[model samples]
Target: MTAKDLESLLTIYKEVVEKIDLGIHVIDSNERTVIYNKKMREIEDMDIDDVLDKNVMDVFHFGPAEESTLLQVLNSGETIPNVKQTYSNNKGQEITTINHTFPIRENGVVIGAVEIAKDITKLEKMIQENVYKKGDTRYTFDQILGNSAALNEAIETSKRATRTTSSVLIVGEIGTGKELFAHSIHNGSSRADNAFLSQNCAALPDTLMETLLFGTAEQAGTEGRPGLFEQANGGTLLLDEIDSLSPALQTKLLKVIQEKKVQREGGTEDLFVDVRILATISEDPIDAIAAGKLRKDLYYRLSVVSIFIPPLRERKEDIDLLTSSFIEKYNHLFGMKVAFIDEEVKSYFQEYNWPGNIRELEHVIEGAMNLMGHEDTISFDHLPIQFRHKSSSSGGSNDLEKIEGLLYQPDKAILPLDDYIHEAETYYITKALQHHDFNVTKTAKALGMSRQNLQYRIRKYNIGKNTHS
Candidate 1:
């Protein structure tokens, strides 16, 4: 390529990065910002001039216990994907984002780091202000879908929980709607008229969490702020991801639960609080205890009313209902008239395990809806590339049947040798794409070819375009 061509290509890449919806921040090994995209500036509420050529720690006021994910990845030379992080900028504006930070390497040596962030600050505020606001939880028992035996049993247990103010521990895998159940319990109880608040134990450092839970005392330079316990007095307080709390914090929490009071940091007096504690742990209490992630005394106290929500794979019968619900939800949100999914796609959903549970199914439906146009129904082709690839790799019966039919049908005309080879190559590449979830880099690695070569073949065969159809 000529110098002018290279320059044009670079310009195009820069424009694409700038215009992308996700915030992109790249830092050198020395921790100086190299590329802070427009979206990143908008997300962080900072000017490019404030970030570019500046140390990330200098720009963001990270506490002593907290570290930037970008810097962590830079030093560890590892990828940290899909992590929810909450931090404040230098101006004290708190920001929440889901970041995928990766280490940039050259010739097998770590050089710098890049972080792609999706800002969720507004989402967090909405949850705190509206969803978990006083007497205004958006979810109730009626909103908990799925009639599977396991789910129904859990629902029954949760319903019983609303009858008493004892601490309840909700145990389940991630994305199992533990918070939804917590909201339902709060809404149904006698304390339903009071404030309902929630805080994720894993989202902040211990010191910050300490202040957030037990308000700080009025000191000479700063004013006193009521914590979630005080704010949620006479109501319900949900401590989400409770297993992430340190033992010391757990002991403090136990004291609050037992004494029905909170003594603010640096304060001498204990304020009485009638807040009912409802905690959620993604792992079983037994497992969490064995793993030393939860205090035994705290576990026993919190499990006065234990509710275990079954994983999606365990409640396979609910997949169809959940899928329909998600479809309806996205249709209204996307303003698309998707009637239903094809039987094959439904079967694929049933057969495949949803590790992310209902949330994953909902996301799959949402993702497929994004790829739709005038189509009223979601077919195999409409499914996300990841789902399609997983289905192919699982060797579904339908796939095997199709292959058997193709081979056994003697009435079908045989193609020339070159034509047959071309068709076979297309099929293999299409399956490879499915297996790799349509990731060009991974597919190339598995196929023993360069990514450029795989892209050329993908274009030549139009692998993803019509294969699903």
Candidate 2:
């Protein structure tokens, strides 16, 4: 072939090599880079001047990985195909890729090695973003509202817990806002910019749980998809109802938590994962251990910073505030202005024991809101039948007799006759309500007043403060 023909052929080859999207590096057995392309520079976020005609190892830092495929291929005269690698280049840009590296041989002798890398940094980033909503920060510390000493102490502890990467264990009854604490902690942490994932340990079987939490290897040429751990790489994972895990699974979880790495199913390498583990359990820790439901070793590792959430009944002082907040929430939702909760209704709420905690109270209020018609207040008549009977059954005729005998003359009679009559009328109205079994509808008729007038008087005097409707 003529010299001009060879020159034209060389130019065509250079254009083809430069246009390939994958990063390509060709190094001779001596380890000096002979061919470097624009696509390679783009993938590594470096310039051609830095890597062109330079030593391959000097331009790319490839340690921390158990083996370097290109370095191995150059020395062994063999092929290494589709090996996954995660490392930062000399330019300080982090990259993850699948490399097809092998030797280029001539006359049955190894001449050089070529590395073609498929960049996966973008794909992994996309997976992380998928777990979280772009604009939605679901929960924050401000959302958890309460003022009791126990609740306030827990809140302060939770705020401190968010600043560290240590494991957190939230202990509470079923509906005492364990999940809310989990979300708030994640949002408040440095991992707020990354993903946040939650999985209920009881929601899946032990075998399936392993695959879902650690990840599964994909079929054929595609790479394995990330699991909850990989997806929440730099963020938090709430293992809700973690006591439901079997002892076998508990052992596995302990290893993952300690190692800070996960070995995917059908995949050989242990991928390093920086995930914050936040776990929730409903049972008392001591009782759970005695019952063989929660493993002691696993609990020790997870409860590095433990938080105990008090039940609603224990924080009764906040019941009035919570009721008002829920009322406002429903008012905007249902387009109804529920002015207040009746005095009789508040009394019953204070006396009853809330076994199901705050969640049950919210449901009870929501039920009353749905049943409310034109009335602006939530009365005992609007309560669910079960809730009404909870208080009425325990209260009986003794309460009425106490009110009847409560009528007492003022120390000094008021000079204004109208004011005196009003004071006396308020007292008589209270007696009539107790006589009618604390039923406002029945009491109004017996007192020869309209139902609206009886309600007005009850509010005016703050009457029936201790009555159960």
- In order of appearance, the predictions have TM-scores of 0.61, 0.58
Cα lDDT tens digits, model 1, 1-469, are 9999999999999999999989999999899999999999999999999999999888897667567899989999989876667899868999987678999999999899999997867655644653366856889999999989999999999999999999999999999899899999998899999998988888776765786788767754235667789889889999999989899999999998998889998788899999999999998789889999999999999999999999998999998888888889888998889888876687678778778888888888999999999898898777788777775556533444343224456977766667756676677777667855677776675555799898888888777863321
Name model 1 segments beyond 4 Å from true: 1-131, 394-469
| Candidate 2, run of 10 with poorest lDDT | 398-407
Compare the candidates by TM-score and give the number of the best one.
1
CA lDDT of each prediction against the hidden true structure: 0.84, 0.80
Q: Put down candidate 2 lDDT per residue, 99-199, tens digits, no spaces.
A: 88889999989989999987766645544453343224477889887899999999999999988999999999988999889889988889888877877
For residue 417, model 1's alpha carbon misses the true position, in angstroms, by 28
Q: What is the lDDT, from 0 to 100, of the residue 357 in candidate 1?
A: 86
Which candidate comes out best when scored by lDDT? 1
